[model samples]
Target: RIDAETRRILLLELQVRPGIAALQSEQLVAKAFKTKVNMLRSLGSRVVMTVLEEVLPAAAREAFRKATSSSGAAGAGRGVRPAASTAAPEPMPVAPEEHALAARPPPAAAPPNAPQPAAAPHAE
Candidate 1:
């Protein structure tokens, strides 16, 4: 049978092994976290550089070019123009029937007999 002192030594050794293993596990987790944080930081820096160096300058240049090339008319600052209507233009002489209809006043609202919509409830 093992002596009491030897048994105590073995117990302590066993305890130490698990403690070392836990410490190693903690170290691994910390390393992985650090690596992930660094990778994210690098990615964020790259994205910022791409936007500031490439995308922003390109967009600014395009906007400047458009503004400079736009028409000289008043209120034409941004190179944007009002879209022209695709529908047919008004006829030179207005039709008599159409003029009469246009001159007539709009019809009145629903009669008193008609059911009215329910009013929405107000919240506090």
Candidate 2:
């Protein structure tokens, strides 16, 4: 299961470097996670775009769109039109339960006052 922290980090990376082609970026991420590049890349540009659209703030999204459009246009004079600047859609709010679960810190030393369970009976 992908954790919230990991997702946040990935989103931040994507936001900071949206000029990288989605496939290349996914390959890098898959390597970092010791997974098959195709597994991640298979999710496709739409998923990556959706994640960026959801996570980045309006200004960041605008910057990303501009940068991507410019880079695509520059490549072989592709003549790609700049994506229209639009207000960023509201981020899908993380569910309260998910937020609560994510916010909880890992248990500290199994708690100081908790009773230790009896050791399992020794086998012969």
Candidate 3:
């Protein structure tokens, strides 16, 4: 039998940090409480129904129900398409000279000891 006190604690923890749904579902709740997937599923459904039906106002519950129903209907009509199946095109072959040219870096400047070209004469 599930412990009411432990269930309330787990539900409160899940509500306090909504982003922890994955951890709550996959590991924490099950590991800590020694519960199985079916139990977790039933507990989650009951928790959700309690919040939606008992905690929420009548107007809010109706709106939420309508939204959920609409989204379910919309999802039924949609189908996911497989990714494009085309193979990648082969790379173009580079010419030998082009490859050699691309591999070489620009030549470095001559050393200071090396003779320099004479500068053009300036007008007075």
Best by lDDT: 2
Q: Write the residue-wise lDDT of candidate 1 on 24-99 in tens digits.
A: 7545545555665566555554344455566567777667546645736663433233567999998699789999
Q: How far is candidate 1 from the true structure (C-alpha RMSD, Å)?
A: 25.3
Candidate achieving higher lDDT, 1 or 2: 2
lDDT of 2: 0.67
Residue-level lDDT of model 3, residues 1-88, one tens digit each, is: 4577776686666453566667555466656466554554555544565667978999998897676558775664233334566998
> Best candidate, TM-score-wise?
2
| lDDT by candidate, in order shown | 0.60, 0.67, 0.66
Per-residue lDDT of candidate 2, residues 26-95 (tens digit): 6666555545345545665556567888999989988977876677534533332346679988899788
Error of 2 at 115 (Å): 54
Order candidates by TM-score, high to low: 2, 3, 1
